[model samples]
Target: MKLQSTPPIPASDRQSPPAVLTLGPASCDAAILAQLLPVAERFRLNSAHLDPGGLVGWLDRLEALFEAEGRSVPVVVDLQGAKMRIGRFPSIPRLPGRVELVPGDRSERADTIPVPHPGLFRHAAPGDRLFLNDARVELEIERVGDERIGARTVRNGPLEASKGINRAPHPLPFEALSDRDASMIDASIGRPFVEYALSFVRSAQDAGLLRPRLGGHRLIAKLERTEAIAHVREIDAAFDESWLCRGDLGAQAGVGELGPIQRRIATLIPSLRNPCYLAGQVLEHMTHFPEPTRSEVVHLYEVARSGFAGVVLSDETAIGRHVAEVAGFLARAAPEE
Candidate 1:
């Protein structure tokens, strides 16, 4: 297969912080990618969200587009790690008004939803909370049954298929990488992929466990949990790079400490010679607005001052009204002029 062309790196980009633009959530779609890539070509957000299952199709299409346009970009595959996801249930006439958590990896029945791991059963109890899809949907367990747990929703919104599930920050006796993540890495054995975004890294063990799977690929240890923060130095040493993913980190570090902790982590990585990326909520307001908020402007300056090698966007580029505009502002902030 023909590799996409590697464009000359301008002196400006060499001196500026690199930005990686993400494809839209359903960005896997060929048409959506068609719309997004032209913008990516212009702004040069080299790194993109590459996951396992959809890797080949996206690469084929991306290669065609970039080859046609005469460009190439780095691919970063983000591993889901041991983060828990609500299991699949067949669609009912309507989802139960009551939320349910049943055991197993999948379900096709009514009312009872699948929670997959039996280990979670030990931690959960009545009146405890369950956060689904990054807290977009909340389930407060009213009662726990022998077979299933039932709850009522506190926050209701659009829920994605395979949304993540979590309670509070408690240490699970498991490695950060999930079986699924390992299989994914194994599948990508010979692809010239650039990096692995190892998720849920909580300790040096978490980082070390994944380093071998990467097969010498760049490792971006995502510091999302407080445990990762507590042991940042070792985790930093174990990986080639680090990322401060504020969304999940907020859950692990307490929302109050997300900002301070993000700054602190960003400050630490540069001294270790491990470049860090500031991800999440960088241009969140731009998803709706024509212009960036004053705070967003300040946030960019904070990123640069703290020595982040790059900034990452999720909604701002993926689902934002102005994907290219958001990319432009980010480029301006850390100009590749």
Candidate 2:
């Protein structure tokens, strides 16, 4: 599909702390992608959402589109590494009540949420806290049974299927590289523009283990686990870059603590060797509105001041209502450049 030809982005309009655009289902639409791609400094694709073949096809299209533009943007194939997600279940209108947790990808019952990852069951215990759907819903474990675990929602909210699950303070007993991640990385070989971003990274060793598989492609360590923050220096050294994914980080740490955690990491960026980018929920309100909340704009400038090399827009650019407007806002807010 030919992208409608457009003028090149002006140097001044390019964000100072560059903006990385994350691709989602909505981004697959040609019209939507045409509106979003030019302003992006880099592209991020979640591996879980696309199979190897489909991903290559998407990459081909992206390359073609960029070829038309006379420039290319690096693509980051985001690996799901060690992240635990609940499987498919009908959306619950109201949460905060007791729910059952079982292991599988599909749950037929409304009260049951499929965890699908055995590591969670093996490590979870009574009284442990579980955060789901980015901590909009919080669960307190009531019992850990042989086949199913029981949890009561301490915080009330709606629940959705296939959302991320985080058990913080207690490390999830999963390795950094999942089988799917390994396969996807292997499939991505020989693609010069393709790089890998490892998710849920907890230690430098996790980054170390995945390094050999990339054949020296640049790796970006996503620091979401609270455990990772303590070892940020070592982890930073292991990767070409690091992403401070505030969404899961906030979910793991208390949401109320995200600001403090982000600021603390900001102070450490100057000491780190690799570039660190602020990610997750930047200009989130733009997902539904044409303009971002004033506070969100202020936060972008604050991140720039904190020495973040860039900011990643997830839902904002992926499924947002005003994609071009969102990108323009980020560019206009660029720090003195």
Candidate 3:
């Protein structure tokens, strides 16, 4: 769907840091959508969750609503960007034992795990470590085969299906833009208010692979990999904006190292080519409950006071039960400007 020409924002409101809210299946509710729109300066759609058609439907409604008010909120489509993930199978109750990683999106046996990407099978080796479900579970590869790899859990925990997969020290070899990402990008073309974000950016070169396909939309680089942080200056020059995705970064960098990594990014904020936004787990407590923890509230305030241009809420606003309360709290806590 083509967007109508957007109305101008009042100059007085431009200086304040913009709150970018991500939309999920839950946001399809009209009342919930209404509650969310007012508090957010921008909206984000995850291509992994919402298909191209759904994205268009969302933009149609959002654009119409904002146009009626003589204003517009920018829309960002966050591409999956080769994020490796395990496929469907029964949730593992005992994850410590031997498991076989097989091809495709499903496994018939409980002891077997399914991973859809061929790069995993080709690149995996003995003794390699794999982090699953945001690093909640860890696996050590014991054998590699043409069809699958044998692994044993290093960190034992219950595992669910369709969770994120990562290999440290040696990342998987997935393309920078998946076919789904390309399709979503095509869906977003011709809409002036629409922008695109590349996830799991490892370096300026990774951003280079995606920039040409964005059709002139502003590209935001999600600095989730340690490699990306190491080459932040090059990335700063390549992308229009940057986002510090703490959740993934923590998983990749280890929780103990995340703070230092963030401080490193914080130190380089002045040298960055464009605005860098903070993302992931900002209002995590509010995801399952009504109120954010005191620390979370303080964290939001501190992030605003820090050099970040804005913040992005992941599960907090996407699937949280207390959407209105979360939005209100952010508005009260940060009070943009």
Question: Whose lDDT is higher: candidate 2's or candidate 3's?
Answer: 2
**Residue-by-residue lDDT tens digits, candidate 1, 89-202:** 564433456877888867766566787667678767887777766666667788877877888878665554466677765534444556666766775656674466776777
TM-score of each: 0.78, 0.90, 0.88
| lDDT measured at residue 174 in model 3 versus the true structure, 0 to 100 | 37
Clashing pairs in 3: none
Candidate 1 residue 307 Cα shift, in angstroms, is 1.7
* Pick by TM-score: 2 or 3, better one: 2
**Could you tell me how far off, in angstroms, the CA of residue 150 lies in candidate 1 after the best superposition?**
3.2
- What lDDT, from 0 to 1, does candidate 1 have? 0.66
Best by TM-score: 2
What local lDDT does model 2 show for residue 251?
Answer: 82
User: Could you give me the TM-score of model 1 versus the true structure?
Assistant: 0.78
Candidate 1 vs candidate 3, lDDT winner: 3
**TM-score-sorted candidate list, best first:** 2, 3, 1
RMSD for each of the candidates: 8.6, 7.0, 8.4
Off by over 4 Å in 3: 1-17, 67-70, 91-96, 173-176, 334-337
**Candidate 2: where are CA atoms >4 Å away?**
1-16, 334-337
